[model samples]
Target chain A: MSDNITKGKMIKPENLVYTKSRVMTDNVTSYCPGCGHGTAHRIIAEVIEEMDIQSEIIGVAPVGCSVLMYDFLDLDIQQAAHGRAPAVATAIKRLMPEKFVFTYQDDGDLAAIGTAETIHACNRGENIMIVFINNGIYGMTGGQMAPTTLEGMKSSTSPYGRDVATMGNPLKMTDIVATLPGTYYVTRQSVQKPANVRKTKKAIRKALEYQKLNRGTCFIEIVSNCPSGWKMTPVESNKWMEDTMFPYYPLGDFKVPEED
Target chain B: MERELRLMKGNEAIAEAAIRAGADGYFGYPITPQSEVLEYLTMEKPHERTGMIILQAESEVAAINMVYGGAACGKKVMTSSSSPGISLKQEGITYIAGAELPCLIVNVVRGGPGLGTIQPAQSDYFQATKGGGHGDYKLIVLAPASVQEMADFVELAFDLAFKYRNPAMILSDGAIGQMMEKVWLKPQKERSREFPEWATTGKTPDRERNIITSLNLDPNKQEDFNHKLQAKYREIEKNEVLYEEFQCDDAEYLFVAYGTSARVCQKAIELAREEGIKVGLLRPITLFPFPTVIISRLADQVKGILTVEMSAGQMVEDVRLAVNGKIPVEHWGRMGGIVPTPEEAVENLKSKIIGG
Candidate 1:
């Protein structure tokens, strides 16, 4: 852990540690208190702040709970239609090749309705990063079953638990995208804990660095939590995600560059 | 001081003119009758020449969303599609309108309620002039009847689109899109690096972060934004009504049409004059601004009005509404991709308006 990020009572000029990332605005987020979106949002801000490329970034926010991501991040953002963020990001990057462009999308937006867009944009090898969040259930739409929902997991639509025969199996999208030659880097991480949060931030930073190489697409899937949708407390959701979600979606790099 | 004349199809003319108009990007899916647009762009390699970004998107939906992405940055972006493809693009089109982004959308019309035919039809008049998407939004719809108009309206559409910060559509049909005519191509204009103040170029220390979004969850705020859009539309209707009158002076009958039907109606007017019938044609260039006032004024002088269309009488409703019973208004149309001939059109005008 960094020694500067301490909770101790050391209030000196050099010892001062706690302040919000300047990339994050003062506006209150609309996410549930225990939702991992806030952490994911904070990590994004921290990474952008630390990278010092705040002015060079252009983001496309997806149509989900994080649709208002632009409201929190102090960067130019375009809110996209459901599942079309990657296509939107594709245009932005193609037109402004010099700018750092990315798409912030959730499981429903990535693997379900926008499957064609996601695959084609990735296939095109657009020099952009896709910051994907996989939260098993559709949190914004009252815990409906999402494409990435774990088999046998109960949701509002899958009230009797997801039947693999009828509902299809959970899509390992990170693995699927990793197989694409267009992807330069593909990783699946989580933010259920502080350590995982750090790892995720590092992955995002690496994705941005790889983005500068102009090789291909960089995809980072954050297997996050939705406590309110999961009908669990934040702590319980973390344990459940570690137990159920991680087994199905392991946190690791699926694809890496030959050198990096 | 010589014009560079080229024999081009409407679809090709649009693609060439877009490059000459300094359009920044084009994202389109290849559909019938309009595939030539994407084909021409791909062949021309406009990116290598004019630095225009052209992409063959996976679907019409993705293409329109890509247009949204570019237009968000104040880029002169456009896409061309046929009827079914335009239906697929409605979702993205609504979002672009709701966000008040500027872009050009070209609908090279083919017949369809559902894959009806590959032939020319004006069935989408209701969809285009009226709200095609779910909102109180209207695209600045331009009816390009000729290859020359197809070439000219590319720059005109972008100008109006950027001026009003709204989407503009070039509503051409398969007849016009596939028909070949000589077009005087414009000189190449340089693409701009300067973006608009509201464009999402990037938030620097100099300005606040720019957001291009349609979502205003607050009902009160959404209502206020809707009012603002309506006001903008009203201003457009007041100032941007464009139409052409052919033989309307001292005429007793009016033929209201646009696009392919207008071309047919012009011939019908000549055919009627040969039969000692006094007829004129009022062709609406801007279908949304609609030439409503002129049609209403023309109603006072005309004995009756006939809206000649390729569809089963869609624009007739608007004509009847504009006339408001001051004069009889009737619709003569042929569905399933049938383009009514001049003789048949005059015959319908004679029976539907003069006799009925």
Candidate 2:
């Protein structure tokens, strides 16, 4: 920040086009390069700043690569057990209804191990936001095959490639949850492009706003890329995510509340 | 100074006591021998009275994680389940304990190795007191022998849990949970709105962000935290050992027991005294603290001790450890949902300690 000013650029606060949100901490992120987690974190932080809800929100970080979310976000957080973030957020919102609560979970955490918690929390219409990152593979535990793994996608556990007959069909959590009546707003967004990042931020802001209405659950599935886990460079992974990941996990709004 | 006197099952008493104790929330899944707890809370409509939140989670795993959330907020929250359900909650329980969050867990134990029976058993002694989960952690385990104690211990468990920032458990069983007894409940306490310093409420201008988690990637820091937890456990051991002595003043032999078996041992003590036998009972109320000091002292005075329980000698291992080979310590009991009758208890005591 000082370099921009000290480098004789003299970037005034009023002249600045963009800066890191105060809702984010100075702690360095641990996510791998080209991973969507860092952008997703900053976007949520920016949304919190924009909504002025930094002091009124609680975040639950699921057991996955994003388990250290508390280290980066400048807000209160509870790290939940694998696949238990929804259940944890449910109790928080129920006990302190005035406070905003959300869970940041990954594909393996949300779709596989914590499927019951995810389904039930959404089914019960829990008034919280669920930010799911569907990379379609377990990144933290060395690229294991997740429930959302695309057919023919090769994971470490499924080195022979995901066999649709034995592995069953890829789980489309956003689509499934959108069909549930308990969900008020459900969308699938990605950050491979700048326009998509802005869309995801808007969805986050909208979800956080909708939570105050106590209508029902708001879920966002961010189709993400895992560069290191996918054995590809940042550029290659982005292209691969577009070429392979997007065909199955399309980016668009699947559910929205009726106009009031 | 007025008391709310009522005749209720131990499970019902626990539910009522939690409501009266000004608990912030109760998240639980229904399970046998303890389902009455959730049923009573739902039926009483405590939400209308104290504004406490009560939720029936989809499963025991969800129920316990819900408690983890409430505990993270530094609220008085609890859950109740049977043996099988409690087993399912082990992962969450360990996380809560490791995070050093305060919460209450009530285990109305039914028999189990693998969904064994709906009848009572003390088989979970090793699980509850010895830490059922995969980490080195301890819960303040309170053994409630009757409905009155069940009512009383709920508040006590929450108090100790918050005092030390640790999880606490009320270990009851099918017999006590099913039987009705008269209990004098305490007056209602006002719910606390003031958040604890460590609570993960929102990060205000006055404080840094509060993070409730057990994930420490650094080995040295994790070891230091473990040492700190051990220090807290040692402090709890020093202050929270609770046990009762019955006719142990001039006794030559002792029957060491807890929970349902403690009541059976009391009756057995009376029968043994009727035959001019100098036998007495020592009932441990706090199973985790284990009443080691008193038992060790009694080991010097008594000739022998017959440890009894509904399970096949789980608590006897602790008793033998407490006795420390000072005197003859033996275990006798029946398993597979069988609660040892007073006659059977007395015969086992005589044969296990006095004769055989």
The top-ranked prediction according to lDDT is 2
A147-188 per-residue lDDT for model 2 (tens digits)? 988999899988999999998889999999998999999999
lDDT of 1 by residue, B1-356 (tens): 12479999999999999999999999999889899999999999998888999999999999999999999988999999999999999999999999999999999999989988999999998888787989889999999989999999999999999999999999999999999999999988889888999999888999999999999999999999999999999999999989999999979999999999999999999999999999999999999888889999999899999999999899889888899999899998888899999999999888988998
- The Cα error of candidate 1 at residue B325, in Å, is 0.9
User: Worst ten-residue run, lDDT, model 2 chain A?
Assistant: A4-13
Candidate 1 to native Cα RMSD, angstroms: 2.4
Deviation from native of the Cα of residue B58 in model 1, angstroms: 0.7
Interface RMSD of each: 0.6, 0.5
Q: Which residues of candidate 2, in runs, are more than 4 Å off? A: A1-10
